[model samples]
Target: MSILITGANRGIGHALSRAWQSSGTEVIQTARNSPGMEPLDVADPSSIKELAERLEGQPISTLVCNAGVSLDKFDELETGYAPELWAESFAVNVTGVFLVIQALLPNLRASRDAGIAPKIAIIASQMGSQNSPAGNRFIYRASKAAAINLGRNLAVDLESDGIAVGIYHPGWVATDMGGDSADLTLDEAVPGLRKQIDELTLSETGCFKSWDGSDCEF
Candidate 1:
C-alpha cells in the first residue's frame, strides 16, 4: 500500500514513516525542510498544490496529517498575547491539514480501484475535547478542536466515496511538542497507531480514538 505522511522529518510523523518503510510499504514522506523524505510545506497553499502536481499519478492509500505546531507558552490568556501565534498554530494545524487533504483527494480516490482502504488520519489531541475540561493549552486546544471537527465533517462527506477519516491522540508522546516527561515514545506510539489504522472500518470513521484503539470523546 502507498502512504503519504506530512511532517515526516521528525517525531511521530518521522517514526510512522520509518515504521511503514521498514514494513515494505510505499511511503511518501513530506516535510517543510529539504532533508525531508519529500518536500512539502503543509501551511503553504502553493506548496500543497505543487506537491499534488508532483504526485499526480501516484496512488495514496493513506494520508496522515501529522504536521502541527503548539504555542505552549500561551497556555493562559494574557493581555497583549501575540495573536499571531494563535494564527500560526491554526495555519499549520488546521488550514494546512485541510489543504493537503484537498490536494490529495484525487490520489485517494484512485485507491478505491486498487482494493485498498483509503483513509485519512489526523493527529489530534485529547486537550481538544469539548466534552473534557479545558486545560492550560489555549492555542493548542483551539487548533486541535478545529481539526477534530474537520475530520468529523470529512468522514461524513467522504463516506459515499468509501474513504474513511478519523482522528487519533498519540497520548503525550516524547516529541518536542509532547516533552520529555511524556508517557510514550515514538517507537511505542507509531506501531500502535499503524495497527489501529490497519484495523479501521467504515463504522469507525468520524471517531476520535487513542493510540491503543480506544474511542475518545469529542
Candidate 2:
C-alpha cells in the first residue's frame, strides 16, 4: 500500500511528499501541471477519472486532499467574493475533494483487503471554523468549512469499510498562500500533520484538529 498526496508540487504538499519519501515510504505525488509528477487537477472530474484508471488496482493507504485556492484573500467585503471566485473555490476545495474520494474508493478498499485501515486527510483550515475570527476571505473560509463538513460525513459513512477520515488545520505556514508573516514554518507544521495521519483510527475518524493535534470546534 502507498500514500497519495495531491498538489504535491509546492507548499505543504511538497514538503509532506519529500518528508515521506526521505523516510522511505512509497508516496504517489500528483500535481496539476508539474513535470515528473502524476497530472491531476482536482477540480476536473476527467483528471480524477484518468488518475483512478491509471492506479487501477493499487492500494492507497493514505489520501491527502491538499489542493486548494484562496482567491479572495485581499478583496474587500463588498467588492470581493465574485461569483466566479465562489464557483472556482468550491469546485476545487469541496466538490473536488469528494469526487477524488469517491473515485478512489476501490483503491481504499484494496488497502483494507491488504489489512490496512486506510486514512483520508483533508487539509482544511482553522479559518473554516465558525469560532475562528471573521475574515475578509469569505470564499476561502466557506469552502474550507464545507470541506471539513464533508470529511466528517465521510468519516461516518466509511467507518464500516475501515476507512478513517480526519480534517485538519495545517497551521498557517510561511508560503505563497499563507504569506511570509504566517506563524509556523513548513518544518513545524508538516511533522504534526504526518503524525495526525499516522495515528488516525476509526475512533478518531471524524476529528477536526489543528496541526498540533488540538481539537478544533466546527
Model 2 TM-score is: 0.98
Cα error, candidate 1, residue 121 (Å): 0.6
- lDDT for each residue of candidate 1 in 6-63, tens digit (9 for 90 to 100): 9988899889888999889989989998564688988889999999999997889999
| Stretches of model 1 off by over 4 angstroms after superposition | none
* Per-model lDDT: 0.89, 0.93
What is the C-alpha lDDT profile of model 2 across 46-124, one tens digit per residue?
Answer: 9999999999999999999999999997889867778999999999999999999999999999999999889999999
TM-score of each: 0.95, 0.98
Best by lDDT: 2
Top candidate on TM-score is 2
Backbone clash pairs in model 2 (N, Cα, C under 3 Å; residues 3+ apart or in different chains), count: 0
